[model samples]
Target chain A: MPNKGDFWEVNCYNNSLMYSHHTKQKSLACLALLFFHVLLQAQSPENDFLRSTGKIYSVVAGIVIVFAGLAIYLWRLDRKLTKLEKHINDEHETS
Target chain B: MEGFTDEPGVDLVKPEGIRFPYRSILNETIRNTFFHVALWMAMFSLYLVGLYHAILYLRTSRKDHDLWSEAYNKAGILFGIMGIATGSLWARYTWGSWWTNDIKLNMATIAMFIYFGYVILRSSFTDEEKKARVSAVFSIFAFVALIPLVFVIPRLTDSLHPGNGGNPALGGEDLDHTLRLFFYPSIIALFLIGCWLAQLKFRLLKLSDRVLKNR
Candidate 1:
């Protein structure tokens, strides 16, 4: 969990926000400081608790369904652009 | 659709191989950490990209930069809608409410409204230069406002969301190494998806502009 104080810096440290001089650069400076703090913390991964019997995979499945819909939207958009490009090409060739 | 791969890679499964840490209320839904949380991060990143392009448009007054600015903003808004929808569902299951008075939740709604205003403000002007200039300024102001509304104020106040009230949700108190395995990659994947959407929109915008010029 990240703290509320340096949360902005932590989120931006790795993102591609070149510089805003006024607003962005200041956040970048904060990102550098928080990067070190996250590194030094040690935590164990092992615990003998709940396993997959709880149907967590259903949640994952639902998410996949949502993304699949997004994929279809992209595919249709790509097809429309392709058709437009072909029309533009045909016009140029005839001219 | 015919050539589309169903998923990136099959999810790895083995008996007693690895497991996500369990919490009382968030037991199975902890897996949502990978998807729901990552969606918001991707939305934020796309907004930053939009903000960067808006700044470029203002500085150079380049037509290409203006198109790029609008394209990324559109992608960011799309992802933001997804994020809000997913978070609302998760809240319903976990927080027992479709919407809450939680400061973060309310602030996020306000942030979305601000971006929606950008779209409305941008579309009202028919003159290309005027649209670009005014929307560019609005993008800057909107992003500036977003930083505080989504980031600063939520943290300062008590929020039901983790990373508030001394509960860090990432790799902190709630997240474990096993969850990190899925969480980090999910954020990158969603971020790439947002970028791809922006690029597709930019290409379409450029082609339409060319068509208009030729006409």
Candidate 2:
């Protein structure tokens, strides 16, 4: 389903329009991956050095989760638009 | 500014303690002074701008003024929310919980809800003039209510947050000379950022209005 408050997606009529969102999607994914790597290190005994710094770093984890959620949301937006594009293209083909 | 060399009243050498205070429980998280506290100041500045525009909209009946007011209100709400998030984190470390029952926090939350009501009131109207008129009125009242909810009522009663009956704000050792240098700048910086966000929102609203008008 189309999401609410989708201003950019409203006027998407070309490939570049979709790719604009695709580029952001990748960046968001990379950021989440970077956080994942850091969190992985934190799980280890030897690499748990960040634990000594206190609760400030947990805010970083919260930020990572927010970015991850945005990435997922963008992926869903891409999928929804692609489905609509396919439907329109199929209709043109049958005609 | 970088070297502080030959600057009067500023210790060029290792003369005095100017770093963040080592408060119990607060510790290094006192660094949040720049982020959490400044955010509220920024939010307050944005809401003040919004309040001004709201009155202008009422006086001139210009749709642009109404939109500008709404934009600033939106930006103010965003900063307020971010302030809440950063404050929650700071509280977690210092207050030992994510939230607590305090006059300050509760009143601030109420202030936010009143601002949120402005948005709801704006969205409720389908007619352009009706929305603008009501939104302008609502935003003005929201900001007026915000003053007491955030600043006045909190000081009247006891609060775990600073600026309380006993714990006077901007008076303690928590904010030192070094912190003052960064904290004041952060408020202005974040206030500019909030205005920029409001400008962006205003553009978006104008675009949407134009698009819908064309249809």
Candidate 3:
């Protein structure tokens, strides 16, 4: 992925080309190449398929399920302990 | 100044860019550095607390101390598992595999096994005092062993993991100022949450012990 740095470099290269013969045509050619570079990047299928279709929601859902399981298990264990405490207190009171 | 040297194709006379360094392999998933690395950091901090409680148990021989140690250790192991999972996910995207033969990963598994053995050893003893004493000793041994297994040995050998065998890990070009902003906060948050879980587990265990004694 050509970042801003690459764009800056291309602009610098374009400035250097300004001193050469047929300056206007060459500069226009560089401009065309820059547009093509951006177009190629926009059309790239590498990471876009998952991201654009929002299929990453599946991954997020899986993680959320795991976390929810842990939380629910902890909550149940806490409730069990509370019940056990109450049962023990009732037994002592009856005795 | 540092940003200028980040990209190879960038012209020397051009101004520095605002965006992150776009490496060929680690394009956007480099953000995983914060999540994955922070989990490991939180795990280590929790383990250190567990070790401290183990030492305290050995000194005081208190049942509560043992429970605290066990709770913290369990919480720490949970964080370690999360770290490994996140790391594997990040690896799948960057390294083309969920798991690799990297020395760091091997050593991490070993470290986890050593801690698991500590828990298994604790469960084998029926007597509370005996279990506490034996596990405290084992905890200390495992902590010392893990230092070499996880940190020292991995760095000594050639590995795909960064910061080992000439690879620069985070803080040395891998992590930059922008990444650090998120990374440090993630570490702090994970650590706090781990501690909270440990505290909850310890209280639950303590309450169970009291109920058993009352019965």
Candidate 4:
């Protein structure tokens, strides 16, 4: 025992919910597709591992080079410091 | 205290002036480097330890081995949490996000949870031996899962995470040459500190065991 207006309102509400649900599902699917597309674009040049490995090697090399530079700097500084200390000691001994 | 020190081979006289290492002069602000890198190094090390224990536990079926594995697994998870916090703070300045969906970031989150599941699985078991053994196996699997989640899958997919998908790691570009001067040393020092902490925790466990045996 439902009036025509009541039936119409209920139908409208149900339709809206269904529409929203459908759009949400579609949106999720679109997102997944987009994610895959981005990944493909990123890796499209070559195999993923190859590209990543190259980057890793470059990073490792850079780290090595930087460390080498630091070592040289420290070594030179140590030598200079040693020379200064010896000079000061010689002056002190002479006095 | 003074009389006792002079009495024997033990010379406990304090030095006139304390000289700290050049690195120590960097101070507590430099502590962030330790706090950040140590956690990750510990996390990586413990994961390897857990993996080793898992294999041993499978071969020998020893409960103690399983316990050792579980302890390291727990430690790894704890360190992983610390790592995330430190990394987030570092990122707030560097990447400008409290959190990012970057590959490395997301993979780290996944890695944390995967090991956390090992703890959860351990809790679910009622029997002590069963819990240890089951958790040991789970830890191994979790480590395996971690490889793909962290290294493989993330790289295969697009990610903002450094060191993946042709993006440079946090060495040259992101961390400048000047920063690298401090950063590399910091990594080594922090790693040593992590080993020290883990060793201490392991020793504490052994001490607890001894006390319990005496009781």
Off by over 4 Å in 2: A1-51, A54-95, B1-18, B166-174
- Tens digits of per-residue lDDT for model 2, B1-215: 02212232221122365644444444355567777788889899999999999999999998899989988898888788877777775565567567988777888999999988888888888899989988888887888899889887877777776434544565474356677898899899878977876786687677657545754
Candidate 1 residue runs with Cα over 4 Å from true position: A1-58, A61-65, A79-95, B1-15, B167-171
Rate residue A31 of model 4 by lDDT.
57
TM-score of 2: 0.67
Tens-place lDDT digits, model 4, residues B1-215: 01111121121222354321112112112224434554576578777887898889889997566666765675676567667765664454334456987777887798888887887898897776777677877887899888877667776676643323643453244333444566667656645544544454455455444444554
Task: Provide the TM-score of chain A alone for each candidate, in the order shown.
Answer: 0.45, 0.47, 0.41, 0.43
List where candidate 3 sits over 4 angstroms from the true fold.
A1-76, A79-95, B1-19, B162-164, B167-171
Q: What DockQ class does candidate 2 belong to?
A: incorrect
Residues B33-74, candidate 1: write the lDDT tens digits. 787788888889899999999999999999998889888888
DockQ for candidate 2: 0.07
Angstrom error of the Cα, residue B43, model 4: value is: 1.4
Give the alpha carbon lDDT tens digit for every residue of A1-95 in model 4.
22335434544544554445564877756655665565445434432321232222223333343344335534654665566557556757877
RMSD of each: 19.6, 12.8, 15.9, 26.8
Candidate 2: Cα lDDT at B187:
94
**Candidate 4 or 2, higher DockQ:** 2
For residues B26-93, write the lDDT of model 3, one tens digit per residue: 54544565667777888888889889999999888888889989988888877777777766766655
Model 1 pairs in collision: A1-B168, A1-B169, A1-B170, A1-B172
Q: Which runs in model 4 stand beyond 4 Å of their true positions?
A: A1-95, B1-38, B162-164, B167-185, B204-215
Model 4's CAPRI class?
Answer: incorrect
Question: Which window of ten consecutive residues has the lowest lDDT sum in model 1 chain B?
Answer: B1-10
DockQ of each: 0.10, 0.07, 0.05, 0.01
